[model samples]
Target: MEIRRTPVLLSWICLLLAVFLIPGHCFYLPGVAPADFQKKDPLQVKVNKLTSTKTQLPYSYYSLPFCRPDTIVDSAENLGEVLRGDRIENSPYVFEMREPKMCQIVCKLTPNEKDAKDLKEKIEDEYHVNMILDNLPLVVPIKRLDQDSPTFYQHGYQIGVKSPHSEGKDEKYYIHNHLSFLVRYHKDEQMDVARIVGFEVKPFSVKHEADGKWNGDKTRLSTCDPHARQTVMSNDNPLEVEANKDIIFTYDVDFVESDVKWASRWDTYLLMADDQIHWFSIVNSLMIVLFLSGMVAMIMLRTLYRDISKYNQLETQEEAQEETGWKLVHGDVFRPPTNSDLLCVYVGTGVQFFGMLLVTMMFAVLGFLSPSNRGGLMTAMLLLWVFMGLFAGYSSARLYKMFKGAEWKQIALKTAFLFPAVVFVIFFVLNALIWGEKSSGAVPFTTMFALVFLWFGISVPLVFVGSYLGFKKPAVEDPVKTNKIPRQIPEQAWYMNPIFSMLIGGILPFGAVFIELFFILTSIWLNQFYYIFGFLFLVFIILIVTCAEITIVLCYFQLCSEDYLWWWRSYLTSGSSALYLFLYATFYFFTKLEITKLVSGALYFGYMLIAAYSFFVLTGTIGFYACFWFTRLIYSSVKID
Candidate 1:
């Protein structure tokens, strides 16, 4: 009886553990649980932020003088949503399931000068109004003739349009005062339930006129009337938005049954051009890897093997001394590199980044971080980075010990602060600019304090603990002993120059991922979904291989040239790829984006600089470890006595 009771208690504990360990979205099952609705059920339409690609800024939906609900309440947001400037709030627009309502009057607003100016600015900037229904974002569908699937989706509808004045003078702003909403739902005949799968809208600007004396009834409008069955046309006189002008807001809702299921409803929204480009990127990266693999194989199997054989066969000290190249520099090759402290910090930071990305990608590939869990990716990344401080400190401490550095605590402090400090300063400056612009993209003060707390209160203490543990362990042993006097490096050819070799080595790694980078940039800046974590993980692996191989190849060349200063060279070799990344970003900005504001341009470059710097550290660390391993292997294989 006691044994049976023990098993039952253990089983109950296991069940509770599983429930808490699983992702929040997993409870909902197949792609966010369906919200079932019966006929005539009230469906609340929630308004989100007004976003503009040109400015890369988001404003609240009610920032403009539009129709408002009696009491506005912001929805609860996750950390990622807050960081991304998503401000979702309850709106007055409500729809009934399977109910069609035409020419429904929402409200009327008379704009002041300030409101008119703000609306005009948003129109000129091409701001789009985002709304949500049943967790599905509203989109404007576009039909493409050349595609097999004829329709593509634009995430949100434009707030208004700037048109030339009737007299062909200056441009005038025309607000989209009327919206035609189409909600598509999947209905289960057996269960007698319906779930919304898609939300679409077609907006129009109608200068509505009242018949006879104007009443509060919407059927009295001449432009759109439900009783008369009069609908708003595209060619109807547009409503001009100006100071002291009345803007009548109206909408029509039509529900249609769709064949798409609740599980696969997000498919249409996530669709892009094709997977051909991704495959092309993979093939291109594979080609680089194959080429580098051939080079590395030749060096290892033929050149190094031959050198080792010849050296081992030498019976006299004179014969051994006659041999030149890498064999002559075994002593200085393991010597501590210049700026060892900085190198340790960078390597530690890279380890932190690598752990964060690797774990995040694994979770994403496992379907833990689904699109339904909005902002989960970013949130996971931040938390993972913070927790990875332990690894960062440990790695830095071990390297510092290997370098024979006396102050382990100093190095650990540097490792903990250097990288994050640079990032925080840049982020703070960018946030200040956004705040001055009155954009929702600016992180609030509370969030800022939270970030600071996560860094100092959590990450810093973890780093100190890791550093202590690492310092208590014995230092790593070098394969070859270093001499008291450093060997003078021989003259190197023009191609063997550090700058030339580093720049040349970076090209291969950059080529490995530039295509994938384009799609990533598009997803972030253009407000599209990026749910291809599997492919991204593959690319990431390929990128690591390419960086390591390129750096190893360059390090071999430098070693053969009798240059023992390979540590920094190895790092820079792969890290220089970031330079190309920044240059490509600049090119992308000019060609792909239509950013006209100086602030927007500054923001783009500033954020891109941070990305490039991180890339530099990540790739540089990969290269250093690869070269370090290569040197140890070769030096250990040969007789160093």
Candidate 2:
């Protein structure tokens, strides 16, 4: 029995894991707590004054004083007490709960801190509630200087908060908490602006956190969430600073657990998982395995066998069928793709991108970048994309030379400029739109100039080198020559046209994640949390499979129709996915997203263009290779005079 080793084993394992194990064990941001810190030497400090404090904190906050004693004191013994007693019922406020529960709370401060503390005492005296006073870590100030203007500063630091649970084991912890700070300024300007700048998750986690629980041994703490670090500013004098400096940044934490517990059940597994991103990634990885299996099987078993047998037969008989498919088209196999210069540049860039995707997926699968890694994945992808310009130039020049395009200097120049120019133009326009909205994600002007500099300095040299190598290599020789007379065109149905079919092929995949697209768009435009890599990963798989299969089917039709112009068809068909992506964004604007016209329209189309162009090159490559092989195989089988 012939054994298919690589894909069969890999794909089967992936599929089983996804179907049976993923749903339960693949939480997004799992085991995200700090290491358990035992008091090495308990500070001999007395609570000079025992005061209970209650303040309405933001609903999104999911932290508490876990490290050191803080300004705010609670009446309850533990966090559960505050949730059960002080929470309002059926109120419009964010923290307003039904009788004694709050679903979504973005914190609303009650009376003054003293009044709130008095209320806490009254509630405790009348009805007993568990109140616990926990100490928190000290906040460190950080500053980010504008490279262009050093004087102007953007202050921010990495916020590291640890949940009160062990690193690996799934356990529940308290959430209703607030950070109280008393800042004494040594010296300050008479008038200056002060505000909380930015906060981000740090990469200190040793293990993944399932849902919100820390998983692993109790002796160790998960670094998934260290602390919330923020850059604060103020121009208030020392007296005012001290008076109001007892600033309480109240917040609540999310406790990830299930009402019912099962050791190995799906729900329990999911509960123990990290975050929603893991769910999407698992699905995406499974689909990719499926896709690779199908494609490899076709290549190794069906296509390879047929091609080898035909080659042997042709040599022995010295005669072949007239209707040989791919074999008959060998001469044109190395023909320059349309828009040779542009195509060369794109393809070269695509090679680099392909490498990045492989590396990223491997890293992710290896657990260095589980779904719980937050922006680590995006940061990696961004760096990879920026650095892959060399591949774009190289692949483009090499392919162009293979196709007998000899304008080396021009091809190199085009390759160097194609991606950087287009991206810069698109990004600039998007930044302009973002300028109006005051969105932080906008690429700054200095960064844009730096991009230009890099393109000229880095990409240009690489392209020149790549073109030199490509030109130095000999042109690929074809096994067969094109006949003087063109084959008669066959009548085709409406659906057979490349344009129409490409449009049709992209619809289903787009539909599958149109709802998901809104979440992504909102993150980019409205600055919402999009840490759902699992969902994004799933959508990516759907997109790739849909593009590949749809393009392949379309290319097959064009070939059967005797349309030798199958080159562009393969590309455009797969590229049509970009069009659908754009269309979905447009639809999202009207139905799902809420944004002004300037930010909405510009960013929408700007990103669309990039997506479309990238898809065009990727899909085109797949189609061209597929059609080329098919043509060569069929043509080679034919008898020649």
**Judged by TM-score, which candidate is best?**
1
Query: Which whole-number lDDT from 0 to 100 does residue 208 have in model 2?
Result: 19
Model 2, 480: alpha-carbon shift in Å? 2.2
TM-score, one value per model: 0.94, 0.53
lDDT of 2 by residue, 1-641 (tens): 11123434543444345434542133322223211212131211111111111111111111211222323343222222121122211111121111122111213222355543433333322211111111111122223364452221111111222234534433221112232222111111233311111111111111111234422222111211233122111111111111111222222222122232111122211232244545464455456446645865575478656765775567656465454544444444435557666656666765656666656654443333443333455556655655666566667766777666768788778777776678777777766665554433444466556556656776578668766876777765555675555555556788776668778755644554555666657555432334333345455566555555555555544654556666666656655666777766677666754434444556666776786666556555554455556555555554444
Candidate 1 matches the true fold with a TM-score of: 0.94
Report the number of clashing residue pairs per model: 0, 85
lDDT of 2 at 407: 80
lDDT of 2 at 296: 50
